[model samples]
Target: MTSAVDVVVVGGGQAGLAAGHHLRRQGLDFVILDADAAPGGSWQHMWDSLHLFSPAEHSSLPGRLMPAQPGEAYPDAGHVVDYLADYEKRYNLSVQHGTRVDAVRRNAGQLMVEADTGTWRARAVISATGTWSRPFLPATPGREVFTGRQLHTVNYRSPADFAGQRVIVVGGGNSGAQIAADLTLDGHVNVTWVTQRPPRFLPDDIDGRALFDVATARRRALEEGRSDTGGVASLGDIVAVPPVRSARDAGLLSVRPMFTRLTADGVRWDDGSHSGADAVVWCTGFRPALAHLAPLNLRGPRGHIPTDGTRVLGEPHLHLLGYGDWTGPASATLIGVGRPAREAAHQIARQLST
Candidate 1:
């Protein structure tokens, strides 16, 4: 059985919720499908010590400001989960939890959303399925033969799991830096942090809020036919959060060049140097979680669905929200998702009216 709606939002995480807010304002009939049984989305699975790069006031959705946690400069993962749950309730958004979408394809003039629970036919589809589920692990030689434990950022929970082991943390992104710092803080594990390039740290004072501002400026410059001033990338990569800062200050967060291959017991660098390790953690980041959209055949050369803002190129009825800056300036972040969400909702509303 197919239930018809004006819009069907896939993935009820932060991005989905933001789109829901704007869609409701447009008075559109829509349903948000979420795979998670509860409201927190991926925040529920973040490592125990994870915290936002910005304060609560700066990180929020369209309708409400995230309430600040007392005495916390940066709200932790638990607070974010609580906020998302409360945000869903506060807005009364129509979210169908535990319904994982299997595929999305065109049926007649509308898009058919096939899911675990049932089906929905909608004039427009919004794919807000973020990258959390698709952790990327680089193809290092001899990785298959490695005898030690291997894990990705998605599998990380706490430093306790790797306690007393010699661990090598890979990648140079925020996750890699944070996890390396986290392990150092544990004081039980011997950590060797490696990256493909030298790790870049933002100024101690710079946070997500500033990065968002830079992204906005860079986006405006590009759209207006001006020279690209270079966005957040110009500042640096790592956010220099409190924990990372503390560990770096203590000389516990030293980084080395990435290893060229994995050995039976450990890893080997390009210079023929080797280090033994009991475990290896890959914080290499994630690709967009768009496997369900494979039937659409919309992927481009870079393995991404080409888009004009949030709207997918060549598919006017489909919008891809919250993938990253490609979807919008900073659409992947909590606060940054609002602009793109609103634009996508407005566009969908206009398309439906015609």
Candidate 2:
């Protein structure tokens, strides 16, 4: 059977939940379609030791605050998952779980979302499907032939999984740094960190909270016709979370330049040095999940949908939430995502109402 709504949100994570909050406040008929069987979105899949760089207060959705668990300074992945589940119930947002949207296409001036279970015909569609599902591994030569246990951050569960295994963690981002630290600190595995460029650590005081504030300022600056924030930091850089800090203090954190190529057992550096490792953990990040929207023919060669803010350039009835900085600066974060989501909801509500 086909369902219909005024708007259909394509994800149920923080982004979709944020959008749902505004859509509810706007009193619009909307339904959130979540691919996962449960409420946590991608957080549930994160490594067990993963914690937000910011405190619970800094990581929150639109209408609710993330309450910290007892004695926990920074919220862990499970905390986030529980909070997300609670957020949905607290707001009474309409969500259909396990509804993986296979494609979104224009149908008679409305967008039709084709999912695994059924179809949703809506006046407007908000594509909040974030990048977690689409992990990107750099095209390194011999990677196809490397006969080791290759895994990405998405599939990574815990350091115990790699116990006593010589592992190479690739990428300079937070995931790369954090996993490397986790493995090294546990003293169970040898981890070699690799990045294309040297990793930059934000100031000790600078956490995800500060980054959100900076992103907000930058977004506000652009909106108010200002060009710069006097030098806003790139959100892509790593934040010094507690474990990461501990790793640094213990002198366990070290990095290497990107490898020339992969070998059967390990990687080969440009200087002809070879490092043999048992497993390679790719924290190389992800591309935007725009495959469902491909039917709209909006994706560019870079696999991104060009947007004037959150709205697609030519497709006025479609808006993309979450994803990444291209949608809005730091729009993927729990705190930073609300701005674009609210904006998108407002825009869609206005369009549907009129």
Question: Which candidate number has the best lDDT?
Answer: 1
The weakest ten consecutive residues by lDDT in model 1 span 299-308
Per-model TM-score versus the true fold = 0.99, 0.96
Measured on C-alpha atoms, candidate 2 has an lDDT of 0.89
70-177: candidate 1 lDDT, tens digit per residue: 989999999999999999999999999999999999888889999999999999999999999998888889999999999999898898998799999998989999
- Top candidate when judged by TM-score against the true structure: 1
Task: List the candidate 1 regions with Cα displacement exceeding 4 Å.
Answer: none
Model 2: worst 10 consecutive residues (lDDT sum): 228-237
What does candidate 2's lDDT look like per residue over 1-354, in tens digits? Answer: 898999999999999999999999889999999999999899989998999988998899887889987878998999999999999998999999998999999989999999999999999999898989999988889999888999999988888898888899998989999998999999988889989999888888888878877877887898799887842355447888989999988889989998998899888999998989899999999988878888899867665568899999879999988877789888899988988888998998888878
